[model samples]
Target chain A: MEAIIAVLLILMIAGSIYTLHARDLLSAIVSYGIVGFALVIIFLFLKAPDLAIVQLVVEIITLIIMIAVIRNSSKEDLQERTTVKVEGVHYINLRSALYLLVTGILCIGLFYYFVKSIPGLEPFGVHTTRMATTYIEQGAELTGSANLVTGILFDFRGYDTLGEATILLTAVIGILTILRIKGKKV
Target chain B: MTLFVLCFILFLVGMYGVITRRNMIKIILGLCIMEYSLNLFFVLIGYVKNGVAPIITKGTEQATFVDPLPQAMVLTVIVIGLATTAMLMAIAIRLYRKHNTFDIREINTLKG
Candidate 1:
């Protein structure tokens, strides 16, 4: 399971990088979907079926919306100007390459510190939960649901779910407002 | 530890895209990538070896279950991430309509 998950993570990284460099806007959006669906599989391997379901549905909707928007606009990314032609040979501009090198080094250094700074964390797949023990022990009995994740989502953390719904409502309203034909009548 | 580090690298790739990309859609895609990495990290932290899904059934009443809290939280996070992505996409469409291009450098209006 861990090996499969590691492979999927690598696939997700490759997909994200592809999205960054894709020339066609539609292909970039499709590659973005690849990262999301890869996540759904990882969630399943980790024994979080509820999250997998949610991610699957949400990813489909997001892809649909992105594709709809892309259809009505330009298909080309137009960010391909990063490369300059010098006497028939294309070279990445100096400033962009420099920025990439610096940020790459800094992020790698940060990743090193992240793993080293937290020596107390139980290694992957051997987690010791401080609060989840109660949830697992009595969740089914208290909530009368077979799924503990659902019990916590709707019963234990119902208010947070409500807030999440509210945020979605606000986003829809905001999208409608922004996409309107006119912001203010002249 | 290796899984965690790889997840962090995913995040850095997203940050790099957002910081360096010139297209509006690419920046939004970067934000989406960052969100995915963070959500995966949360789920990874909750996993347990030999643990089954957090669903309680009659036959497996005594079986160990993975942590349920992060799974629940990630459900909410996934929904919220879609909301934000939709919002950003909407804004990007409106900007494209107004400016006639998706290039951020060409959309600038503050230059004198």
Candidate 2:
């Protein structure tokens, strides 16, 4: 099981990386969507179903939004205006080379830092699993819902959900205001 | 272990898009990439070993159930992503109308 998970993780990471570097904006969005989906799978693995559901929904919405943006980004511009021909196939520039080198080093460093090693890391010394189980055992009674995830989200950590909704409202309001500027059709 | 490394790669890709790419559309795409990496990170945070689906099965005692919280939240996040994407698209369209070109290098109207 661990081996399989490790493999999936590797695939996800690779896909995400490729998505970022892909020249096409559409491909990048698609790659990012894949990352969101993978994260949903990961959340399931982590015993956070509520978070996974929310994450998936948000990702889907975001992807759609990005597609809309990409489509309109060049609505009135010449397609040939921003061509980036002759990208690194020739002699590599020193600045670009150095940037890649530093980024590579950082990626490797972080990968090792958080790779499923929970040694003496239990500063709380309490089983997180147990707290969740306890929440599950009592969630229905406390939140009046059978779905423990819903209960946890709306009761145990209801504030987080509230914050999320508030943020969405804020974003929509801001977007509407900006679009409503006089003589502006954005 | 390697999966963690993959996150780094995804992050790096997004960063490259943001820093090296001068096109506004490309920059937005890069930002999306970065946001997506975060979503992936959140999902990975909830995985478990030898876990089975939370479905109730006959003749089953206790089974490991993957957390469903993040999954639920991701759905909402996707919606939020939609709103942001729409706003970005609108802005980009406006910029194009005003500037008449997609090249970031030639955007003199917004120069301070």
Candidate 3:
């Protein structure tokens, strides 16, 4: 299981890098899709079937929307643009490269120290779940829902779900308002 | 443990993309990747060894189940991500229509 997860993580990293570096817009989108699907697999392996299902569906929808947006713009137009120029020099110079390297190392070092400082965290699994245990043991009795996840989502944390629904609705409305064509008034 | 570190690395890669890339779509993709890495990290944090799914079935005896809170939360996060991605894509499309390009460098009409 560990080896499988490690492989998947490596694949995800590679896919993201490819997505970032791909010159062509279509290929970049495809690489991003690859990363999304790998994430779905990782979720399944981590025992989060609910997340896996939701991620799979959302990944497909996101890919479709991105592709549709890409289809509207021409490839040549997207490629002809250059980076920000400073005194006739491109932004991707030695200074920016060194800055990126230093920042990456600093962030990784800090994260490593923080992870080491945390006590009682096992290597692979065995997380101590106080609330989760309570939820599992008394969830059915409290909410009368067979699935504890469903019960928690709809009954226990219903307000959060409601908020998420509202956000989705607002996003749809915003998209419609932004994409609508304006008629000229003579 | 190692998985968490790798996830963080992925997040950093996304950050690098967002900071360095000049294309608007690539930046959006970087943001999406960051979101995915964070979601994965949260789900992994809730994993238990030899754990079954959180769904309860009749006449089944299970001792351990994965934490359902992160799963539920991630479900909401995924939907929220979809909405945000849609909005971002809409804005990107509008930008393209106005500027005829997706490059962030050239869409600088507000530069003083």
Quick one: best lDDT, which candidate?
1
Ordered list by DockQ, greatest first: 1, 3, 2
lDDT score, candidate 1: 0.87
Q: lDDT per residue, candidate 3, A55-128, as tens digits? A: 89888888888888888587532433335588987675564566577767877786778577555555568778
Native interface contact recovery, model 2: 0.30
Candidate 3: how close is chain B to the reference, as a TM-score?
Answer: 0.92
> What tens digits encode model 3's per-residue C-alpha lDDT throughout B40-85?
8788888889988888886544568888998989889899999898
Residues B1-112 of candidate 1: C-alpha lDDT, one tens digit per residue: 7898889889999999988888999999999999999999998999999999988877889887888898899888888898899999988888777777788877775242
Whole-structure CA lDDT of model 2: 0.60
Error of 1 at A2 (Å): 1.1
lDDT of 2 by residue, B82-108 (tens): 667667766765666666555666775
> TM-scores for all candidates?
0.92, 0.68, 0.88
Model 2 TM-score is: 0.68
lDDT of each: 0.87, 0.60, 0.83
**Model 3 CAPRI rating:** medium
Task: List, residue by residue over A45-145, the lDDT tens digit for candidate 1.
Answer: 88888888888998999999999998989999776456899999999888778777887888878877887866767789898878988888888888988
Candidates sorted by TM-score, best first: 1, 3, 2
Sort candidate 1 into its docking category. Answer: medium
Worst 10 residues of 2 chain B by lDDT: B52-61
